[model samples]
Target: MNKWEILNHAETACYQEEREVLVRGDRRWITALHYAFQDDNYLYLAMDYCVGGDLLTLLGKFGDHIPEEMAQFYLAEIVMAIDSVHKLGYVHRDIKPDNILLTADGHVKLGDFGSCLRLQEDGMVHSSLAVGTPDYLSPEILRALESREGYGPECDWWALGICAFEMLFGSTPFYAESLPETYGKILHFQEHFEFPPLAAAVSAEGRSLIQGLICEPQERLGAGGALDFWGHPFFSGVHWATLHHCTPPYQPTVSNGTDTSNFDVVDDCLSRMEALSGMRGSQPAGAHLAFVGYSYMATGETKDCSRDTVMSTDKQQSGDSEGLIRDNLLTESVSEELPKPFEHHLVLSKGPAGHVHGDDTDLDAAMTMELHRQLQEAEQRSRGLEEEIRQLQGELESLRARRLTELNIHEPHLFLPAHRLDATGDGKLAPPACHYPLVIRLHRHLLLFHRVWRPGVTGESYLLVCAAGVELQAWSRQQSAELS
Candidate 1:
């Protein structure tokens, strides 16, 4: 009988968008986001059962780079997934091994829209701020932040390139000791990087695809847009229209929906919370923020959670915080009731042993000593990059993904043209220009929207739409005088 208190409208907008995207029921790459709801206090989301867990879990099981044939299948599916996301006019900023979940039947579904950015409908794409996993963060995103500029969906392709590298090599392409160093390598990698032996074994064409995607923003393979990346020879054999129908290269063996063997501790915890939906408690003692969404079965009916909850849920007594947190999706633990973080990270020993330093007999006997010395240093940097990959993985496990929509949360632009009045002067201000679509030149200041009721169906039923704007005239005047 507990509940979550809802506050910010923008946060709800994000949660709703995520739910809607999933509910679209696109079989090619979409996951099932069953429902979203809210009481006076908390938001609840129910998603589909991906019993096979995530790609990262499968990687850990293999103890190294997955076989190239299997990696190819996943990488191709990811491309199709990215295509679907773009078609929806959103950029999934976080597309890594963890976010790509697997079904028991062995297909991929792209979930986790917490880091998504919706582009403006009128062809004017805007970038607010940088976000996403450090290991997969695109170079242009980092550069845009440094230059105080904006970015677009191209960032996702760069990340796709990183995903490809991790799949084939079990390490990132630009791994470094620190964030800045890693970013620098990303910016300069085009002129310098080459496929290591582990990756080269996949195919020269595959390496070329990565090289093209992992370049500077202007020259990036996906900069031309989604179709360009799909056309790459790396996916030469792929028939996009039928990928969903074809058998997945590796299908997870699922005994039941409750299976957690493929998942890590963090994923297992969430899976456990999801399983424990029945005894879902009342509003926690002091929590306020709540998430909300709308969901249904493919038939468009609200699912019968009563029966499902009783069957899938755990018997453990519900904790105070668990009511609001229907799903433990964040990478970091949100409360003490959650299990401790794992200490060990699975690593790939799939390094190109002796690939860099071939036998001296193969070296030209007449070759200059200086050339040999440079080769040795290059090998060392490669090794350094791999070690740094391990560190980045650790960092991924430690960080928490923030719930609030950090970008443009405040309505900085305060003025709109008089003729474009959606409000009839109840004096309430409009929402943020960067967020709310606009036809007028933007002016920065405070404006609040007012809700007014009017008869729609002989006043029988109603819509709770904001009907007017009531700008705070006196405060604006006072602030203007102070600025002077």
Candidate 2:
């Protein structure tokens, strides 16, 4: 297809729509706008008009690095954001400055889940997918295409750490000239990555927090989820739950509701969209690809969980932009609304960079450098060995699970991933028991169910043979055949 024909497919724009509807609709101040309406060639999202612009623009306005206090405020919002989505069983594969936005009050919100991963309720969220902005990818994600295993929610924390680093240093912690060099830095992060002289003024507590989150997946911070990470010394005395309530560092200058003064792209996009309703009859009314049902949004009447939107779907209200914009905020039919800032800490200061070696002194800087060198050497020796062990372990688990399934034997010792299981009996979670050979609907997607039986002790390392409801019996048969 020609470029024009391809652009009409709604795929690019709908990625924004789908993610916002599924993930960002979580009722937080740190995300994007939502579905508005659609035309034949365009799908309009009824998103809040952020007059202050996106984080990238704001960062540039701040001379590449936001004030330490502002960065802290934004980072806290985004941290809570990712954590919320992870809890909702969604993984935002893409997290970066470009996807984050600011409101009139400098309230930061992360947008664009077009590249999100929805974890299956069957505890099969482990994915071979390694898609994300290269600068923000975790080491595991940086090499996921190699071994194809699970990284889970830890990957988001890594990306979050990169954002934290950039907020302080005006650039990513391990950025380089080319993709290869960038990957190399991430892999050998302990050695190649170091705080620049500018970061020296940052608090030791803050620097350690970022360092902890950016480490290897196993050693990365947030082992106990956001709850644990919140307690880190880096954020000590900083109120997290109420940070949203704090007054933003820089408030924007805007008066009207539809003003696009801050976002040049939005202004240009709308100008082109002036032809959407054929104001000049240059385009055919029926010659369009973007549909309301197909795209994500707030159609006055047809809005439902099943996404029953289509071209023939009648408009729920008058065909006016103001009406659609109003619906985005006040309409009960849509799932999202204008995000309001919360109240909390009023003042914060930049943190010192590194204190792991000792006090924040010049002699301690030498110690810090030496300490990092030693850590790198240790990591290099242990790097390649992990892939080998992980491969062998995966093979063993598959064999054991398949054997038990074939014999129709239930191994009580085997359990699914702990996150996917329910807790009982001395607070231990293992096998998440559910009736087998079943199909159920979550949100709107149908899911197929199956169980992986095996002999294991961790109770959190098992996998349930559940897949999307493509063909339950057939899929199970194929799995068994591979084992046989």
Which numbered prediction scores highest in TM-score against the true structure?
1
User: Each model's C-alpha lDDT?
Assistant: 0.57, 0.58
- Tens-digit per-residue lDDT, 337-369, candidate 1: 111111111111111331112222222232345
Model 1 segments more than 4 A misplaced? 1-13, 121-125, 197-199, 223-226, 229-231, 267-484
Q: What count of clashes does model 2 give?
A: 20
lDDT of 2 by residue, 38-96 (tens): 54444444555455678877777788887777776677778777776776666677889
**lDDT for model 1:** 0.57
